[model samples]
Target chain A: AQSVTQLDSQVPVFEEAPVELRCNYSSSVSVYLFWYVQYPNQGLQLLLKYLSGSTLVKGINGFEAEFNKSQTSFHLRKPSVHISDTAEYFCAVTDRSNTGKLIFGQGTTLQVKP
Target chain B: DTAVSQTPKYLVTQMGNDKSIKCEQNLGHDTMYWYKQDSKKFLKIMFSYNNKELIINETVPNRFSPKSPDKAHLNLHINSLELGDSAVYFCASSQGAGGSLDTQYFGPGTRLTVL
Candidate 1:
């Protein structure tokens, strides 16, 4: 079994400000981690993923995340965010043997203000 | 081209009525899933299918059912719809990669309202 926990429910930041969305997980077996973004009235889009070999992973829209195995965390970060970057973000994980089913977190909403 | 698509973007129906939401993926992926997002914004997995095989069936009520005629289509049918069934349903698909590690593309969600 695998479960994900995104620490913050909402985050408010100004344009060009650095932002970080914290995520942690607990799983009994080898798992894959993913970050997804959903704009208002839109479906989710993949932001980043942690599969193997690399702790640091870069994604679209200048966003990036680091997969920390020892800490069991995959935190997303961006140095400078744009107004269009405001959206809901989700963290998900699933055990490989579980037939590709994902266990998602509660999700974090990023409110980028001008 | 749209990778994933769902029909009937909005649906409003009375209790006891039956409704279905259609979903399709053009990415040639072999895995498909149905997820529900509640009013409070919590997303939960309802079902998962791969190559027309039922894979993961969550603790969801039996009223909610998913049917996949082929790898490119996964449709959901709800019977005896109740007020509690009102929520945004999202359909997603991904490549049949081991460990469920592939990137999934999602459809614009169907906002179902059970009145």
Candidate 2:
């Protein structure tokens, strides 16, 4: 079984400020990491995924995450954020066992203020 | 247009009542899944179907039943709903035999509120 932990439950930032949402996972075998975003009363949308290769993976809406294997972390970062970026973010993981079952974190709500 | 869709966006019912939520995917994918999102925003997979066959059934209560009529439709029926069952249910679909490379597209969730 795999599990994900999001350190912060809420993050507040001013518009055009940088932000980072930390995520860590525990898995016995190799795994794939992903970040998803959800707006109010809407379904989740994929922000980015880390299957293999480069540690730094870029995603939509100018968001990026770096996969740190040694630290067991995949933290999502954005250099600049907008008011529209206020949403809930989830970090998920899945092993390559072909089940494609994603274990998600408790989510971090990013509040981008003006 | 709505790659994946779910019916009855909001369901408000009394305890012990039976209800069903319908899901359909037109992405031509062979696999469909049902996930529950709690009030705290923790998403968990409940059941999955591949080509109308049951594949992944989690440790959910027997009261929650998933029915797959075909490759594109998966319906979840809950019997005697409890207060703990009040949450958002999301339907998703992916391609290629449940591989990680396939991205799962999600439908606007159905919020179930049991009173």
Runs of candidate 2 exceeding 4 Å displacement: none
Among all windows of ten consecutive residues in candidate 2 chain B, which has the lowest summed lDDT? B96-105
Residue pairs clashing in model 1 are none
Best by lDDT: 2
The candidate maximizing TM-score is: 2
Runs in model 1 lying further than 4 Å from the true structure: B97-99
Cα lDDT tens digits for candidate 2, A64-110: 99999999999999999999999999999999877779899999999
Candidate 1 lDDT over A1-114, as tens digits, reads: 778999999999999999999999999788889999999999999998888887999998899999998899999999999999999999999777647777889999999999
Clashing pairs in 2: none
lDDT digits (tens) for residues B1-115 of candidate 1: 8889999999999999999999999999988999999998888888888899888899999999999999999999999999999999999998874137677789999999988
What TM-score would you give candidate 1 relative to the actual structure?
0.96
Cα lDDT computed for each candidate against the true fold: 0.91, 0.95
Chain A superposition TM-score, candidate 1: 0.97
Q: What TM-score fits each model?
A: 0.96, 0.99
lDDT of 1 at A70: 89
